[model samples]
Target chain A: MSATESVITTQKRSIWAGGMSPLKVTYGKLMMWFFLLSDAFTFSALLITYGLIRYSYPGYEGNPADFVFAPDKWWPIPEKVFEAVPFLHGVSAPLVFVGIMTFILIMSSVTMVLAVEAGHRMDRAAVEKWMLWTVLGGIAFLSCQAWEWSHFIHGTHEGPMVAEGTTFFGANLLQNQYGPPPFADLFFFITGFHGTHVLSGVILNIIIFYNVVVGLYDKRGHYEMVEKVGLYWHFVDLVWVFVFTFYYLI
Target chain B: MTMASEESKTIQVTPPDKAKIRKIWMTALFLGVVTAVEFVIAFTMGASAFRTSLFVGLTLVKAFYIVSEFMHLKYEMKVLIWSILIPTIFIVWLLLALLIEGEAIFMVKF
Candidate 1:
């Protein structure tokens, strides 16, 4: 083939056309993607370990009564474990709080996307407003998580004593009212780790919101900062989806 | 996009378009619906391997939706997307190895 023909043949075919970021994404956004990828593995490892240990047990087998913590193991039903809403004391509402928490995270993610879109259009007021909502959502999620932890730690308000057979109630680093002790450990580790991420996301978002207020991005002429922060916020939401599924649902 | 508007040396303030905001709202609605379905399924379904698989599959769908829509991975370069995704094959490997090996260890012990 002629030199020109070879050059033409070897050139990137439509796919790899853009220089570094063929899709035209920003550097910070690309780095955020990498960071999320690494974080995904960390979560996956923890989750897989949870699966291993959980399956090793005999499982609840439907009823917690027939279940035991011995050779034939039984992990407590998550629904039975987390069955409390804020003020509705003594009510048996399983997964209600978690459902609300899921909605909150998703709405925050929406606000985050809108903020990024506003950044794209250089709408400072819109960016700030949407970002503020996003920050509130994060705080709300963190607060919900705190209440959950405390509730778990405090156990039931006025239930039977702990000496009721092999079964335990509530949770801690030690034994949990849940069937298997490891189950509580996994719950604490996975959700606690996720809560820490949510905490960091809140802090990062506040800084970005402050930046938007001070016209920092406005001066820079672009709101890529909002987009970068949005990526992290969305990732936190994404991980929560999996956590919600495996921990609570399954 | 340039930081400063050509007309103004300062930042140009363009208003957020309604159509785009509506689309974002719809995405949020879709995510919420999916989660609601998962919640309903959790209550209705009993513990079985099939139910567990269903939950895993649904979780994956939700995960992908968040990554694509919220994280904007769908709008990213294919190379960049693959660079982020293909490596996840190791997670599959890690899971299989850990689970199988873990089971083997459990069997040996108990």
Candidate 2:
């Protein structure tokens, strides 16, 4: 490396090694990875705890695997229970909508990656376009989640014969159409926590999107901000993979 | 140093290479396909013991991609990898043991 380049690299290393960087990454990129690692542990703890609880309460009913339209002694299957949309009555899209949401988030993550790539290329227009797409993706995912939560809360009632200790939204801690307690409680707690993460991720994307538009990172010279956010965005997507497997699939 | 000036100075640094950028995108595509396959397996297969095993296996595949590629742990230092992995293994073992014990307690109570 040239003298100036070598000096810059050494200075960067020392600054990061000593800590006290606002971005936490002397490279800005490495700090994002560290943050993502800690975040992974958080999601892992929640998911593994969900698994423990799920296994402990086996055969309670409302099997996510084999769901139906109406509630029975068996738990409403996950696919069946979460198969409707808000205000779109009589449309049965079991897991289809959530699947779409998943793809959307994944695609947004792809766009974010591309933006990071563009940042690396110093292609200002490309970065701007992809960042905009990424932000849109986040918003779309959030909207879908909102619809899902609403559908879950305002569940459809079939009969007047109320099953004591049974809830409209399948088995929950408060009560369920099937299964024991802790099932619903765990479901709410785990999925709710993940939803909150998605919400924060959306907010962060918006902030980054704004920054990108204003040419904050472009003027500064490095696209590490994009890289950092890209890590976080991917991490969110990563958490969803586990959640989909444990909560819905298995 | 003042925060504003420091921030400005940091922003002045240039971006990385095009090859690294392309690598990230290619890795993401791979992750996407793996995830799709996971969903397909989960949906099509029956819940037999073997199927469950397969599902777990696929889940692991997806997890590997997310950790190694998306999270870039694969490129990280060996010490970093071991530090994370070892603790994760211990935690998983502890969780399983506790779950088994917890189940036993539940059976006794209920």
**Which is the leading candidate under lDDT?**
1
Q: What does candidate 2's lDDT look like per residue over A131-171, in tens digits?
A: 88987888888888777765664555641223555345534
Off by over 4 Å in 1: A1-23, A62-73, A158-169, B1-10, B105-110
Best by DockQ: 1
Q: State the displacement of the C-alpha of residue B79, model 2, in Å, after optimal TM-score superposition.
A: 3.8
Candidates' RMSD to native: 4.6, 6.8
lDDT of 2 by residue, B45-86 (tens): 656668666767777787787678666668776755675567
Note the DockQ of each predicted structure.
0.57, 0.27
Query: Mind giving the per-residue lDDT tens digits that candidate 1 earns over A171-231?
Result: 6777766556787789889999999999999999999999988778867778998988888
The best candidate by TM-score is: 1
